[model samples]
Target: MTIMVLGIFIAVLTFCLELYFKEFVIQHFHSIADQMVDKNGVEPGNIEKFYSIGYHNSLIGLIIILVGFIPIYGFPVIYGLISFTAVGVVAGYGYIMDYDVIKTMMIAFVPHAIIEIIPILYSMAVGMYINKNIIKRLYLKKNNTSKLGTMCKKGMKSYLLIVVPLFLLAALVESFITTFLIDRYL
Candidate 1:
Protein backbone atom coordinates (compact mmCIF):
# COMPACT_ATOMS: atom_id res chain seq x y z
CA MET A 1 0.00 0.00 0.00
CA THR A 2 2.80 2.37 0.87
CA ILE A 3 4.60 1.39 -2.27
CA MET A 4 1.51 2.03 -4.35
CA VAL A 5 1.04 5.45 -2.79
CA LEU A 6 4.66 6.31 -3.31
CA GLY A 7 4.52 5.19 -6.93
CA ILE A 8 1.44 7.32 -7.61
CA PHE A 9 2.99 10.33 -5.95
CA ILE A 10 6.16 10.10 -8.00
CA ALA A 11 4.21 9.73 -11.21
CA VAL A 12 2.10 12.80 -10.47
CA LEU A 13 5.14 14.85 -9.52
CA THR A 14 6.95 13.90 -12.69
CA PHE A 15 3.92 14.85 -14.76
CA CYS A 16 3.57 18.21 -13.08
CA LEU A 17 7.25 18.91 -13.49
CA GLU A 18 7.12 18.00 -17.16
CA LEU A 19 4.06 20.15 -17.69
CA TYR A 20 5.46 23.25 -16.02
CA PHE A 21 9.17 22.80 -16.69
CA LYS A 22 9.43 20.75 -19.81
CA GLU A 23 12.34 22.70 -21.20
CA PHE A 24 14.27 22.47 -17.96
CA VAL A 25 13.85 18.73 -17.73
CA ILE A 26 14.65 18.28 -21.38
CA GLN A 27 17.79 20.37 -21.02
CA HIS A 28 18.84 18.33 -18.02
CA PHE A 29 18.26 15.11 -19.93
CA HIS A 30 20.14 16.46 -22.89
CA SER A 31 23.10 17.41 -20.71
CA ILE A 32 23.10 14.00 -19.07
CA ALA A 33 22.92 12.32 -22.48
CA ASP A 34 25.78 14.43 -23.73
CA GLN A 35 27.89 13.48 -20.76
CA MET A 36 26.98 9.81 -21.17
CA VAL A 37 27.84 9.93 -24.85
CA ASP A 38 31.19 11.49 -24.11
CA LYS A 39 31.98 9.08 -21.30
CA ASN A 40 30.32 5.88 -22.57
CA GLY A 41 30.28 6.33 -26.35
CA VAL A 42 26.53 6.74 -26.72
CA GLU A 43 25.66 8.56 -29.91
CA PRO A 44 24.94 12.28 -29.78
CA GLY A 45 21.62 13.37 -31.22
CA ASN A 46 18.20 14.84 -30.47
CA ILE A 47 15.83 14.08 -27.59
CA GLU A 48 14.07 11.29 -29.48
CA LYS A 49 17.32 9.50 -30.16
CA PHE A 50 18.40 9.83 -26.55
CA TYR A 51 15.03 8.57 -25.39
CA SER A 52 15.35 5.54 -27.64
CA ILE A 53 18.71 4.70 -26.16
CA GLY A 54 17.38 5.30 -22.66
CA TYR A 55 14.43 3.00 -23.31
CA HIS A 56 16.78 0.24 -24.39
CA ASN A 57 19.18 0.78 -21.51
CA SER A 58 16.28 0.60 -19.07
CA LEU A 59 15.95 -3.07 -19.99
CA ILE A 60 18.92 -3.92 -17.81
CA GLY A 61 16.94 -3.03 -14.71
CA LEU A 62 14.09 -5.17 -15.98
CA ILE A 63 16.48 -8.05 -16.52
CA ILE A 64 17.68 -7.67 -12.95
CA ILE A 65 14.12 -7.69 -11.66
CA LEU A 66 13.33 -10.79 -13.70
CA VAL A 67 16.43 -12.54 -12.49
CA GLY A 68 15.51 -11.54 -8.96
CA PHE A 69 12.14 -13.24 -9.30
CA ILE A 70 13.55 -16.66 -10.03
CA PRO A 71 12.42 -19.17 -7.42
CA ILE A 72 15.75 -20.59 -6.29
CA TYR A 73 17.98 -17.58 -6.91
CA GLY A 74 15.62 -14.73 -6.28
CA PHE A 75 15.44 -11.02 -5.38
CA PRO A 76 17.46 -11.31 -2.19
CA VAL A 77 20.51 -12.73 -3.90
CA ILE A 78 20.25 -10.30 -6.80
CA TYR A 79 19.74 -7.33 -4.48
CA GLY A 80 22.69 -8.35 -2.31
CA LEU A 81 24.96 -8.56 -5.34
CA ILE A 82 23.81 -5.21 -6.65
CA SER A 83 24.07 -3.56 -3.25
CA PHE A 84 27.59 -4.91 -2.74
CA THR A 85 28.67 -3.71 -6.16
CA ALA A 86 27.11 -0.28 -5.67
CA VAL A 87 28.78 0.10 -2.30
CA GLY A 88 32.14 -0.92 -3.73
CA VAL A 89 31.85 1.60 -6.55
CA VAL A 90 30.76 4.37 -4.21
CA ALA A 91 33.58 3.58 -1.81
CA GLY A 92 36.12 3.58 -4.62
CA TYR A 93 34.85 6.91 -5.92
CA GLY A 94 34.80 8.40 -2.44
CA TYR A 95 38.38 7.27 -1.88
CA ILE A 96 39.49 8.74 -5.19
CA MET A 97 37.79 12.05 -4.42
CA ASP A 98 38.97 12.05 -0.79
CA TYR A 99 35.48 12.99 0.32
CA ASP A 100 33.42 11.70 3.22
CA VAL A 101 30.43 13.65 1.87
CA ILE A 102 29.57 10.81 -0.48
CA LYS A 103 29.10 8.49 2.47
CA THR A 104 27.01 11.09 4.25
CA MET A 105 24.86 11.60 1.17
CA MET A 106 24.43 7.87 0.77
CA ILE A 107 23.19 7.55 4.32
CA ALA A 108 20.75 10.40 3.78
CA PHE A 109 19.59 8.93 0.49
CA VAL A 110 19.06 5.31 1.51
CA PRO A 111 15.90 5.80 3.54
CA HIS A 112 13.92 7.36 0.67
CA ALA A 113 15.91 5.67 -2.04
CA ILE A 114 14.24 2.31 -1.52
CA ILE A 115 10.80 3.84 -1.84
CA GLU A 116 11.81 5.81 -4.93
CA ILE A 117 13.97 3.26 -6.71
CA ILE A 118 11.39 0.49 -6.79
CA PRO A 119 8.95 2.49 -8.95
CA ILE A 120 11.73 3.47 -11.33
CA LEU A 121 12.71 -0.18 -11.62
CA TYR A 122 9.11 -1.11 -12.28
CA SER A 123 8.71 1.70 -14.82
CA MET A 124 11.84 0.57 -16.61
CA ALA A 125 10.52 -2.96 -16.72
CA VAL A 126 7.34 -1.66 -18.33
CA GLY A 127 9.29 0.55 -20.74
CA MET A 128 11.50 -2.37 -21.72
CA TYR A 129 8.47 -4.44 -22.62
CA ILE A 130 7.33 -1.74 -25.03
CA ASN A 131 10.84 -1.23 -26.40
CA LYS A 132 11.41 -4.93 -27.07
CA ASN A 133 8.28 -5.27 -29.14
CA ILE A 134 9.06 -2.07 -31.07
CA ILE A 135 12.58 -3.29 -31.75
CA LYS A 136 11.32 -6.62 -32.98
CA ARG A 137 8.90 -5.06 -35.39
CA LEU A 138 11.18 -2.27 -36.62
CA TYR A 139 14.60 -3.91 -36.74
CA LEU A 140 14.72 -7.71 -36.61
CA LYS A 141 11.94 -8.53 -39.05
CA LYS A 142 12.31 -5.33 -41.14
CA ASN A 143 8.59 -4.65 -40.78
CA ASN A 144 8.58 -0.92 -40.30
CA THR A 145 4.94 -0.02 -40.42
CA SER A 146 3.33 -2.13 -37.76
CA LYS A 147 1.13 -1.46 -34.73
CA LEU A 148 4.17 -0.26 -32.88
CA GLY A 149 3.14 3.39 -32.98
CA THR A 150 -0.12 2.60 -31.26
CA MET A 151 1.64 0.47 -28.72
CA CYS A 152 4.21 3.19 -28.09
CA LYS A 153 1.51 5.80 -27.54
CA LYS A 154 -0.25 3.57 -25.04
CA GLY A 155 3.00 2.75 -23.35
CA MET A 156 3.87 6.41 -23.02
CA LYS A 157 0.54 7.09 -21.39
CA SER A 158 1.09 4.25 -18.97
CA TYR A 159 4.60 5.45 -18.23
CA LEU A 160 3.35 8.97 -17.56
CA LEU A 161 0.73 7.62 -15.19
CA ILE A 162 3.25 5.57 -13.26
CA VAL A 163 6.43 7.63 -13.34
CA VAL A 164 5.14 11.14 -12.56
CA PRO A 165 3.47 10.30 -9.27
CA LEU A 166 6.22 7.94 -8.19
CA PHE A 167 8.78 10.70 -8.52
CA LEU A 168 6.67 13.13 -6.47
CA LEU A 169 6.25 10.59 -3.71
CA ALA A 170 9.98 9.99 -3.77
CA ALA A 171 10.61 13.73 -3.46
CA LEU A 172 8.26 13.92 -0.51
CA VAL A 173 9.92 10.97 1.15
CA GLU A 174 13.35 12.46 0.57
CA SER A 175 12.33 15.81 2.00
CA PHE A 176 10.46 14.56 5.03
CA ILE A 177 12.46 11.50 6.05
CA THR A 178 15.82 13.23 6.08
CA THR A 179 14.56 16.15 8.13
CA PHE A 180 12.69 13.91 10.53
CA LEU A 181 15.63 11.57 11.02
CA ILE A 182 18.02 14.46 11.53
CA ASP A 183 15.78 16.13 14.08
CA ARG A 184 15.28 12.90 16.04
CA TYR A 185 18.77 11.40 15.85
CA LEU A 186 21.09 14.35 15.48
Candidate 2:
Protein backbone atom coordinates (compact mmCIF):
# COMPACT_ATOMS: atom_id res chain seq x y z
CA MET A 1 0.00 0.00 0.00
CA THR A 2 2.71 2.46 0.92
CA ILE A 3 4.80 1.57 -2.11
CA MET A 4 1.83 1.82 -4.45
CA VAL A 5 0.97 5.26 -3.15
CA LEU A 6 4.59 6.30 -3.48
CA GLY A 7 4.64 5.11 -7.06
CA ILE A 8 1.56 7.16 -7.84
CA PHE A 9 3.14 10.17 -6.18
CA ILE A 10 6.31 9.70 -8.18
CA ALA A 11 4.31 9.36 -11.37
CA VAL A 12 2.24 12.46 -10.69
CA LEU A 13 5.33 14.38 -9.67
CA THR A 14 7.06 13.30 -12.83
CA PHE A 15 4.07 14.35 -14.86
CA CYS A 16 4.15 17.78 -13.27
CA LEU A 17 7.90 17.92 -13.72
CA GLU A 18 7.53 17.01 -17.34
CA LEU A 19 5.01 19.78 -17.76
CA TYR A 20 7.66 22.28 -16.72
CA PHE A 21 10.79 20.64 -18.09
CA LYS A 22 9.43 18.83 -21.06
CA GLU A 23 12.58 18.97 -23.14
CA PHE A 24 14.90 17.78 -20.39
CA VAL A 25 12.65 14.97 -19.27
CA ILE A 26 12.09 13.85 -22.82
CA GLN A 27 15.75 13.91 -23.66
CA HIS A 28 16.69 11.77 -20.71
CA PHE A 29 13.66 9.60 -20.01
CA HIS A 30 11.41 9.39 -23.04
CA SER A 31 13.06 6.43 -24.72
CA ILE A 32 12.26 3.98 -21.95
CA ALA A 33 8.66 5.12 -21.83
CA ASP A 34 8.42 5.04 -25.60
CA GLN A 35 9.77 1.52 -25.75
CA MET A 36 7.32 0.41 -23.11
CA VAL A 37 4.40 2.07 -24.85
CA ASP A 38 5.43 0.81 -28.26
CA LYS A 39 6.06 -2.79 -27.29
CA ASN A 40 2.94 -3.01 -25.15
CA GLY A 41 0.59 -3.01 -28.09
CA VAL A 42 1.07 -6.16 -30.11
CA GLU A 43 -0.72 -7.18 -33.28
CA PRO A 44 -4.24 -8.30 -32.42
CA GLY A 45 -3.69 -12.00 -33.00
CA ASN A 46 -0.18 -12.41 -31.65
CA ILE A 47 -0.11 -15.15 -29.05
CA GLU A 48 3.64 -14.97 -28.98
CA LYS A 49 3.51 -11.33 -27.99
CA PHE A 50 1.04 -12.06 -25.21
CA TYR A 51 3.20 -14.89 -23.99
CA SER A 52 6.24 -12.66 -24.08
CA ILE A 53 4.55 -10.11 -21.88
CA GLY A 54 3.44 -12.74 -19.42
CA TYR A 55 6.89 -14.27 -19.35
CA HIS A 56 8.53 -10.95 -18.62
CA ASN A 57 6.03 -10.03 -15.93
CA SER A 58 6.37 -13.40 -14.25
CA LEU A 59 10.13 -13.09 -14.44
CA ILE A 60 9.89 -9.77 -12.63
CA GLY A 61 7.74 -11.30 -9.90
CA LEU A 62 10.23 -14.13 -9.55
CA ILE A 63 13.06 -11.64 -9.19
CA ILE A 64 11.14 -9.74 -6.54
CA ILE A 65 10.70 -12.89 -4.52
CA LEU A 66 14.40 -13.66 -4.90
CA VAL A 67 15.31 -10.16 -3.87
CA GLY A 68 13.43 -10.71 -0.60
CA PHE A 69 16.10 -13.17 0.47
CA ILE A 70 18.86 -10.59 0.41
CA PRO A 71 18.68 -9.95 4.18
CA ILE A 72 18.27 -6.25 3.69
CA TYR A 73 15.05 -4.93 5.10
CA GLY A 74 14.88 -1.95 2.78
CA PHE A 75 15.91 -3.77 -0.39
CA PRO A 76 12.35 -4.39 -1.52
CA VAL A 77 11.50 -0.78 -0.89
CA ILE A 78 14.34 0.29 -3.13
CA TYR A 79 13.20 -2.10 -5.82
CA GLY A 80 9.66 -0.77 -5.63
CA LEU A 81 10.84 2.80 -5.90
CA ILE A 82 13.07 2.06 -8.86
CA SER A 83 10.30 0.14 -10.60
CA PHE A 84 7.78 2.94 -10.09
CA THR A 85 10.21 5.61 -11.19
CA ALA A 86 10.00 4.15 -14.66
CA VAL A 87 6.23 4.30 -14.43
CA GLY A 88 6.42 7.93 -13.43
CA VAL A 89 8.70 8.69 -16.33
CA VAL A 90 6.30 6.95 -18.64
CA ALA A 91 3.41 9.01 -17.33
CA GLY A 92 5.43 12.16 -17.71
CA TYR A 93 6.32 11.36 -21.30
CA GLY A 94 2.73 10.65 -22.13
CA TYR A 95 1.95 14.20 -21.15
CA ILE A 96 4.59 15.42 -23.54
CA MET A 97 2.82 13.67 -26.37
CA ASP A 98 -0.18 15.91 -25.75
CA TYR A 99 -2.31 13.18 -24.34
CA ASP A 100 -4.68 14.35 -21.64
CA VAL A 101 -3.30 12.89 -18.46
CA ILE A 102 -6.61 11.70 -17.08
CA LYS A 103 -7.76 10.33 -20.40
CA THR A 104 -4.53 8.52 -21.03
CA MET A 105 -4.58 7.04 -17.57
CA MET A 106 -8.22 6.09 -17.78
CA ILE A 107 -7.94 4.60 -21.24
CA ALA A 108 -4.44 3.16 -21.33
CA PHE A 109 -3.51 2.32 -17.78
CA VAL A 110 -6.46 1.98 -15.40
CA PRO A 111 -7.57 -1.41 -16.61
CA HIS A 112 -4.52 -3.65 -16.70
CA ALA A 113 -2.16 -1.51 -14.68
CA ILE A 114 -4.01 -2.24 -11.47
CA ILE A 115 -4.04 -5.91 -12.27
CA GLU A 116 -0.35 -5.78 -13.13
CA ILE A 117 0.56 -3.73 -10.08
CA ILE A 118 -1.11 -5.99 -7.54
CA PRO A 119 1.12 -8.99 -8.17
CA ILE A 120 4.26 -6.89 -8.28
CA LEU A 121 3.43 -5.13 -5.03
CA TYR A 122 2.37 -8.34 -3.39
CA SER A 123 5.62 -9.91 -4.47
CA MET A 124 7.44 -7.00 -2.92
CA ALA A 125 5.49 -7.46 0.26
CA VAL A 126 6.45 -11.11 0.35
CA GLY A 127 10.06 -10.22 -0.24
CA MET A 128 9.96 -7.57 2.40
CA TYR A 129 8.46 -10.01 4.87
CA ILE A 130 11.15 -12.60 4.28
CA ASN A 131 13.90 -10.02 4.25
CA LYS A 132 12.69 -8.54 7.50
CA ASN A 133 12.68 -11.92 9.19
CA ILE A 134 16.11 -12.81 7.90
CA ILE A 135 17.48 -9.50 9.07
CA LYS A 136 15.97 -10.03 12.49
CA ARG A 137 17.43 -13.50 12.76
CA LEU A 138 20.87 -12.65 11.39
CA TYR A 139 21.54 -9.15 12.65
CA LEU A 140 19.27 -8.77 15.64
CA LYS A 141 19.95 -12.27 16.94
CA LYS A 142 16.32 -13.22 16.99
CA ASN A 143 17.06 -16.94 16.39
CA ASN A 144 13.63 -17.66 14.94
CA THR A 145 14.28 -20.26 12.26
CA SER A 146 10.89 -21.97 12.44
CA LYS A 147 9.05 -18.70 11.98
CA LEU A 148 11.27 -17.81 9.08
CA GLY A 149 10.72 -21.18 7.50
CA THR A 150 7.00 -20.81 7.84
CA MET A 151 7.14 -17.44 6.17
CA CYS A 152 9.19 -18.84 3.35
CA LYS A 153 6.71 -21.64 2.82
CA LYS A 154 3.85 -19.20 2.71
CA GLY A 155 5.62 -16.92 0.27
CA MET A 156 6.39 -19.78 -2.06
CA LYS A 157 2.80 -20.97 -2.05
CA SER A 158 1.38 -17.51 -2.76
CA TYR A 159 3.90 -16.75 -5.47
CA LEU A 160 3.32 -19.98 -7.31
CA LEU A 161 -0.45 -19.92 -7.01
CA ILE A 162 -1.36 -16.23 -6.95
CA VAL A 163 1.33 -14.02 -8.42
CA VAL A 164 2.04 -16.09 -11.50
CA PRO A 165 -1.61 -16.36 -12.49
CA LEU A 166 -2.24 -12.68 -11.87
CA PHE A 167 0.66 -11.74 -14.10
CA LEU A 168 -0.67 -13.92 -16.89
CA LEU A 169 -4.10 -12.34 -16.54
CA ALA A 170 -2.65 -8.88 -16.51
CA ALA A 171 -0.62 -9.68 -19.59
CA LEU A 172 -3.71 -10.96 -21.35
CA VAL A 173 -5.62 -7.82 -20.47
CA GLU A 174 -2.75 -5.58 -21.52
CA SER A 175 -2.11 -7.37 -24.78
CA PHE A 176 -5.74 -7.65 -25.79
CA ILE A 177 -8.16 -5.34 -24.00
CA THR A 178 -5.88 -2.43 -23.16
CA THR A 179 -4.33 -2.43 -26.60
CA PHE A 180 -7.70 -2.44 -28.27
CA LEU A 181 -8.87 0.45 -26.10
CA ILE A 182 -5.73 2.40 -26.89
CA ASP A 183 -6.37 1.96 -30.57
CA ARG A 184 -10.02 2.83 -30.32
CA TYR A 185 -9.94 5.71 -27.87
CA LEU A 186 -6.43 6.96 -27.23
Candidate 3:
Protein backbone atom coordinates (compact mmCIF):
# COMPACT_ATOMS: atom_id res chain seq x y z
CA MET A 1 0.00 0.00 0.00
CA THR A 2 2.74 2.40 0.98
CA ILE A 3 4.69 1.54 -2.13
CA MET A 4 1.66 2.11 -4.29
CA VAL A 5 1.06 5.49 -2.69
CA LEU A 6 4.65 6.57 -3.14
CA GLY A 7 4.73 5.30 -6.69
CA ILE A 8 1.42 6.99 -7.52
CA PHE A 9 2.77 10.20 -6.10
CA ILE A 10 5.80 10.02 -8.29
CA ALA A 11 3.75 8.91 -11.24
CA VAL A 12 1.39 11.86 -10.98
CA LEU A 13 4.24 14.27 -10.37
CA THR A 14 6.19 13.10 -13.38
CA PHE A 15 3.06 13.04 -15.46
CA CYS A 16 2.52 16.68 -14.65
CA LEU A 17 6.12 17.41 -15.39
CA GLU A 18 5.77 15.78 -18.75
CA LEU A 19 2.59 17.71 -19.43
CA TYR A 20 4.04 21.01 -18.31
CA PHE A 21 7.03 20.66 -20.56
CA LYS A 22 5.12 19.48 -23.57
CA GLU A 23 7.49 20.85 -26.15
CA PHE A 24 10.56 19.18 -24.72
CA VAL A 25 8.73 16.12 -23.47
CA ILE A 26 7.04 15.45 -26.79
CA GLN A 27 10.25 15.61 -28.74
CA HIS A 28 11.96 13.16 -26.43
CA PHE A 29 9.05 10.81 -25.77
CA HIS A 30 6.56 11.34 -28.56
CA SER A 31 6.79 7.74 -29.70
CA ILE A 32 5.88 6.43 -26.29
CA ALA A 33 2.60 8.31 -26.42
CA ASP A 34 2.13 8.44 -30.17
CA GLN A 35 2.29 4.72 -30.70
CA MET A 36 -0.68 3.92 -28.52
CA VAL A 37 -3.30 4.74 -31.11
CA ASP A 38 -1.55 3.52 -34.22
CA LYS A 39 0.11 0.49 -32.70
CA ASN A 40 -2.17 -0.80 -29.97
CA GLY A 41 -5.16 0.81 -31.65
CA VAL A 42 -7.70 -1.96 -31.23
CA GLU A 43 -8.22 -5.16 -29.35
CA PRO A 44 -6.66 -8.46 -30.38
CA GLY A 45 -8.82 -10.62 -32.60
CA ASN A 46 -7.44 -14.04 -31.72
CA ILE A 47 -5.90 -16.03 -28.87
CA GLU A 48 -2.48 -15.90 -30.50
CA LYS A 49 -2.61 -12.13 -30.52
CA PHE A 50 -3.41 -12.13 -26.81
CA TYR A 51 -0.53 -14.50 -26.14
CA SER A 52 1.82 -12.34 -28.12
CA ILE A 53 0.64 -9.23 -26.28
CA GLY A 54 1.10 -10.93 -22.93
CA TYR A 55 4.67 -11.78 -23.73
CA HIS A 56 5.30 -8.31 -25.03
CA ASN A 57 4.01 -6.66 -21.88
CA SER A 58 5.92 -9.14 -19.73
CA LEU A 59 9.08 -8.33 -21.65
CA ILE A 60 8.48 -4.66 -20.94
CA GLY A 61 8.07 -5.40 -17.26
CA LEU A 62 11.34 -7.32 -17.25
CA ILE A 63 13.10 -4.45 -18.92
CA ILE A 64 11.79 -2.01 -16.32
CA ILE A 65 13.02 -4.24 -13.52
CA LEU A 66 16.45 -4.50 -15.10
CA VAL A 67 16.57 -0.74 -15.47
CA GLY A 68 15.78 -0.42 -11.76
CA PHE A 69 19.46 -0.89 -10.89
CA ILE A 70 20.43 2.76 -10.55
CA PRO A 71 20.43 2.88 -6.77
CA ILE A 72 17.48 5.18 -5.92
CA TYR A 73 16.42 6.66 -9.23
CA GLY A 74 15.24 3.55 -10.96
CA PHE A 75 11.69 3.91 -9.76
CA PRO A 76 11.22 7.28 -11.36
CA VAL A 77 12.86 6.25 -14.58
CA ILE A 78 10.32 3.52 -15.21
CA TYR A 79 7.08 4.59 -13.56
CA GLY A 80 7.31 8.35 -13.45
CA LEU A 81 9.03 9.23 -16.68
CA ILE A 82 8.73 6.34 -19.06
CA SER A 83 5.40 4.64 -18.43
CA PHE A 84 3.16 7.42 -17.18
CA THR A 85 4.65 10.06 -19.38
CA ALA A 86 3.67 8.23 -22.50
CA VAL A 87 0.13 7.80 -21.28
CA GLY A 88 -0.10 11.35 -20.05
CA VAL A 89 1.16 12.78 -23.31
CA VAL A 90 -1.40 10.79 -25.20
CA ALA A 91 -4.11 11.80 -22.77
CA GLY A 92 -3.14 15.41 -23.23
CA TYR A 93 -3.78 15.02 -26.89
CA GLY A 94 -6.83 13.02 -26.04
CA TYR A 95 -8.27 15.99 -24.20
CA ILE A 96 -8.08 18.07 -27.34
CA MET A 97 -9.27 15.27 -29.57
CA ASP A 98 -12.28 14.34 -27.51
CA TYR A 99 -14.63 16.25 -25.24
CA ASP A 100 -15.54 13.37 -23.00
CA VAL A 101 -12.26 13.04 -21.17
CA ILE A 102 -13.44 10.67 -18.48
CA LYS A 103 -14.90 8.12 -20.89
CA THR A 104 -12.01 8.45 -23.28
CA MET A 105 -9.51 7.82 -20.54
CA MET A 106 -11.53 5.01 -19.06
CA ILE A 107 -11.46 3.11 -22.33
CA ALA A 108 -7.76 3.70 -22.73
CA PHE A 109 -6.53 3.13 -19.19
CA VAL A 110 -8.67 0.67 -17.32
CA PRO A 111 -8.12 -3.12 -17.20
CA HIS A 112 -4.66 -3.23 -18.73
CA ALA A 113 -2.67 -0.12 -17.81
CA ILE A 114 -3.88 -0.33 -14.24
CA ILE A 115 -2.82 -3.94 -13.84
CA GLU A 116 0.45 -3.46 -15.71
CA ILE A 117 1.53 -0.34 -13.82
CA ILE A 118 0.68 -1.50 -10.31
CA PRO A 119 3.21 -4.33 -10.33
CA ILE A 120 5.88 -2.18 -11.85
CA LEU A 121 5.31 0.22 -8.98
CA TYR A 122 5.64 -2.65 -6.53
CA SER A 123 8.84 -3.73 -8.20
CA MET A 124 10.21 -0.22 -7.82
CA ALA A 125 9.25 -0.25 -4.19
CA VAL A 126 10.91 -3.61 -3.60
CA GLY A 127 14.04 -2.52 -5.37
CA MET A 128 14.23 0.67 -3.34
CA TYR A 129 13.63 -1.15 -0.06
CA ILE A 130 16.24 -3.77 -0.85
CA ASN A 131 18.78 -1.15 -1.76
CA LYS A 132 18.02 0.70 1.44
CA ASN A 133 18.49 -2.46 3.48
CA ILE A 134 21.76 -3.19 1.80
CA ILE A 135 22.95 0.31 2.47
CA LYS A 136 21.88 0.08 6.06
CA ARG A 137 23.66 -3.23 6.48
CA LEU A 138 26.80 -1.82 4.93
CA TYR A 139 26.69 1.14 7.22
CA LEU A 140 26.30 -1.12 10.26
CA LYS A 141 29.09 -3.42 9.04
CA LYS A 142 26.89 -6.45 9.38
CA ASN A 143 27.24 -9.44 7.11
CA ASN A 144 24.72 -12.25 7.24
CA THR A 145 24.05 -14.57 4.35
CA SER A 146 20.36 -14.86 5.11
CA LYS A 147 19.88 -11.18 5.76
CA LEU A 148 21.17 -9.19 2.79
CA GLY A 149 21.23 -12.08 0.41
CA THR A 150 17.74 -12.99 1.45
CA MET A 151 16.59 -9.45 0.82
CA CYS A 152 18.06 -9.36 -2.66
CA LYS A 153 16.61 -12.77 -3.31
CA LYS A 154 13.20 -11.76 -2.02
CA GLY A 155 13.12 -8.56 -4.06
CA MET A 156 13.87 -10.46 -7.23
CA LYS A 157 11.27 -13.05 -6.36
CA SER A 158 8.64 -10.41 -5.74
CA TYR A 159 9.41 -8.75 -9.04
CA LEU A 160 9.66 -11.93 -11.07
CA LEU A 161 6.94 -14.05 -9.53
CA ILE A 162 4.54 -11.37 -8.44
CA VAL A 163 4.96 -8.53 -10.93
CA VAL A 164 5.52 -10.58 -14.04
CA PRO A 165 2.44 -12.69 -13.57
CA LEU A 166 0.40 -9.60 -12.86
CA PHE A 167 1.71 -8.07 -16.05
CA LEU A 168 0.71 -11.17 -17.95
CA LEU A 169 -2.72 -10.85 -16.48
CA ALA A 170 -2.73 -7.21 -17.47
CA ALA A 171 -1.75 -8.21 -20.97
CA LEU A 172 -4.71 -10.53 -21.08
CA VAL A 173 -6.92 -7.77 -19.82
CA GLU A 174 -5.50 -5.32 -22.33
CA SER A 175 -5.98 -7.71 -25.19
CA PHE A 176 -9.47 -8.60 -24.10
CA ILE A 177 -11.09 -6.02 -21.88
CA THR A 178 -9.37 -2.91 -23.11
CA THR A 179 -9.77 -3.90 -26.68
CA PHE A 180 -13.36 -4.85 -26.20
CA LEU A 181 -14.26 -1.68 -24.36
CA ILE A 182 -12.60 0.46 -26.97
CA ASP A 183 -14.04 -1.37 -29.89
CA ARG A 184 -17.57 -1.49 -28.55
CA TYR A 185 -17.83 1.86 -26.85
CA LEU A 186 -15.34 4.06 -28.67
Task: List TM-score per model, in order.
Answer: 0.42, 0.81, 0.65
Our tally of clashes for model 1 stands at: 15
Every candidate's lDDT: 0.49, 0.79, 0.63
Query: Any runs in candidate 2 off by more than 4 Å, and if so which?
Result: 17-21, 24-45, 145-152
Query: Candidate 1 lDDT (Cα, whole model)?
Result: 0.49
lDDT of 2 by residue, 3-118 (tens): 77888788777667777988887676646546544466643354665898899988888788878789877787677566666566667777787768678878887788889888
Local lDDT at 99 for model 1: 53
Clash pairs, candidate 2, are: none
Q: Residue 32 of model 3: what lDDT?
A: 56
- What is the TM-score of candidate 3? 0.65
lDDT of 3 by residue, 116-152 (tens): 7777676656656655555455555656523756765
Ranked candidates (lDDT, high to low): 2, 3, 1
Please tell me which model should have the higher lDDT, number 1 or number 3. Answer: 3
List, residue by residue over 92-160, the lDDT tens digit for candidate 1.
Answer: 333344556355446555675675566555654554555555556555775653375665566556555
Better of 1 and 3 by TM-score: 3
